[model samples]
Target: MLLLVHAALTFMLVGLILMVQWVHYPLFAQVGAATWPAYEREHQNRITFLVGPLMLAELLSAAWLTLHPPPALPSWSVWLGLVLTLLIWVSTALVQSPLHGRLSAAFDARLHRQLVVGNWFRTLVWLLRGGLCLWWLTLLL
Candidate 1:
């Protein structure tokens, strides 16, 4: 049940990131310079509300599962999952969050591009984590 919850959170992030990557972030450049700052701030606030809880739940659950994995799941896999979850947090705090901060101040073309490109790291990590979760869930069945 815990693993199912973890997988559900991870898959939700996977879908969210894919939409942000392909749809949301790309549209930033089109929002117009005059309104970009306010738009960027609103995006930060709204997205944080949606993404923040899911991330925290996934992170805590990943840590718990790492220490007490299902009998069918290998210890190393849970460890990897935890590490990947940590990477997502680290990347958010260190990279993506700062870029959002800069964009909120004023939209820079270079920074907008960086936000779009740098986001690929988190997107890909979630994709990998989602696949791993599905594979691990299969082992239980």
Candidate 2:
């Protein structure tokens, strides 16, 4: 049950990260410069509403699963998932949050590009985590 919930949350997050990477972040440059700050602020606010709880659930569930994995699931795999989740959080805090802060003040072309590029770390991590979940599911079946 815990594994299923964790896998589902990770899968959902994977989908969202992909969309943000390819669709949303790339479009930041299209927002008019005069209003970019406000747009960036609103974007952050709305995305926080959408992602905050899901991220919390993913983090908590992943941590719990690491400590109390199902009998069939290997401890190493759970630990890897937890590590990946931790990497995502660290990347968000260290890399993405600062970029968002700068953008929230004013849009800079280089920073926007960096934001798009830096986000690939998250996108790739989530993709790997999602694949790990699928592998775990197969093991269960």
Candidate 3:
């Protein structure tokens, strides 16, 4: 049951991550500053609206998996997963949300630069998470 939940959460997060990276970020970059002002709220709404539940589900799944380990994930995998989770928190709190705030406030070149830099953290977080998911999945298989 825990493995099933963990796998489902990982798949869902991967889908969302890909959508944000491949679709939303590019669309956001292309939108001109004038147009971006209007779009910002909707963009923020879409992210928070989708992410909140997904985050909760992920947290729960992580907790469940930690409590009841699947054989595929050894002790090291758990530590790595925990580290990735912490990175997610740090990236969201320190990097992504602040960048989102700046970008949403006023669309400018500086804001764009910040966002682009901020994206690096996002990229790292996703990569780490993807690795963790694969690790867990490998354990399961």
Using lDDT, give the best candidate's number: 2
lDDT (0 to 1) per candidate: 0.94, 0.95, 0.72
lDDT of 2 by residue, 1-141 (tens): 888999999999999999999999999999988999899999999999999899999999999998899998989999999999999999999999899998898889999999999999999999999999999999999
Deviating ranges (above 4 Å) for candidate 3:
none
The residue ranges of model 1 lying beyond 4 angstroms of the native Cα positions read: none
Q: In candidate 3, what are the lDDT values of residues 2-55, reduced to their tens digit?
A: 666766776777677777766777667778877887788788887899887877
Provide the lDDT at 68 for model 2: 90
Worst 10 residues of 3 by lDDT: 115-124
**What TM value does model 1 have?**
0.98
C-alpha displacement of 35 in model 1, angstroms? Answer: 0.9
Candidate 1 lDDT trough over 10 residues, lowest sum: 33-42
lDDT of the structure predicted as candidate 1: 0.94
User: What is the alpha-carbon lDDT of model 2 when measured against the actual structure?
Assistant: 0.95
Model 1 Cα shift for residue 70 (angstroms): 0.3
